[model samples]
Target: MVERCKDAGITILPSAGPVAEMFNGKKIASSTRARDLKEGQYPAAVYVPRADTVERFLAPQSTSATAPSRAPHAILI
Candidate 1:
């Protein structure tokens, strides 16, 4: 996503977070994280894009939405 944005001349900035060290790569299109599954923990990733570059995506209202924290294999960057 970052690459696509940058390729299109968008300025992308990595947002400050606890995992600053992982944010080292300029080609990093998303941030990865460890998550728990039914049997164990494993790594997963969340995609991040420059806020100014992406088009608006309307999502369904998550009335039955589980909390983001419950995702065993995906976490926010």
Candidate 2:
């Protein structure tokens, strides 16, 4: 499915207004420059830049995963 979506070309565009991610009652990430990505029939994903994220709230994962069409990415905790 992922490979098929990659072949179809994912669409990425700037999101309207701001985008934010919250955990518990705390804000982990917030960005006005966040991007909305849509691939095939999947739900859109909002991607916030690392610079807009709160560093104190994010801990880098020891191991990272790499997607076939994307670079290796760390899972924050």
Candidate 3:
């Protein structure tokens, strides 16, 4: 999935907070959704990444290189 995103010129920046807390403390750090998932408080842990925060990074991309690809649409988890 990540490779496919890269191929489509969509760079992925994953959150390492979960992993870092898990490994450092030997416990899965709880997030609202993680805890909700555990307790069945919701069907799924849905998240929409804030692309606006990374606007500066995408701003410099060349038009041709960054044109949206049609093969695959965006996926969020």
Candidate 4:
């Protein structure tokens, strides 16, 4: 996935959180110990893939020229 993103000119920033350092590569998993945020924290970060990259990854074998894309779901901290 990292190689594919790089090939498509997508930049993957460092994963954030306590165990983030363990994932040296572009992909990582995250979890929260708290049930939810304290209250004031906004969406500090969001992961949105590039349109073309999403299209390519999702519709590689698609014969149709168009693929419907929707806004990515946002996760609150």
lDDT of 3 at 8: 40
Where does candidate 2 have its weakest 10-residue lDDT segment? Answer: 1-10
Ranking by TM-score: 2, 1, 4, 3
- Over 1-77, each residue of candidate 2 has an lDDT whose tens digit, in order, gives 12234554788778888988999899989899888788779898787889999899887676655656553667575
Q: lDDT tens string, model 4, 1-77?
A: 12123332333343343332112353333332211111124432334323212232232332342323312332211
Q: Please, what is the whole-model Cα lDDT of each candidate in the order they appear?
A: 0.31, 0.76, 0.30, 0.29
lDDT of 1 at 1: 21
In model 1, pairs of residues that clash are none
For candidate 3, the TM-score is: 0.18
Deviation of model 2 at 22, angstroms: 1.0
Q: How many Å off is the CA of 69 in candidate 4?
A: 12
Instruction: Output the number of the TM-score-best candidate.
Output: 2
Q: Residue-wise lDDT of candidate 1 within 1-77, one digit each (tens)? A: 23223322333333434231233343323233311122124332323433422123323343443544332342223
Please provide, for model 3 over 1-77, each residue's C-alpha lDDT reduced to its tens digit, 9 standing for 90 to 100.
12224544433333333321233344323332211111124243323233322232223322243355431344221
Model 3 C-alpha RMSD to native = 13.6
Whichever of 2 and 4 has more lDDT, that candidate is: 2
Question: Where is model 4 poorest over a 10-residue stretch in terms of lDDT?
Answer: 31-40
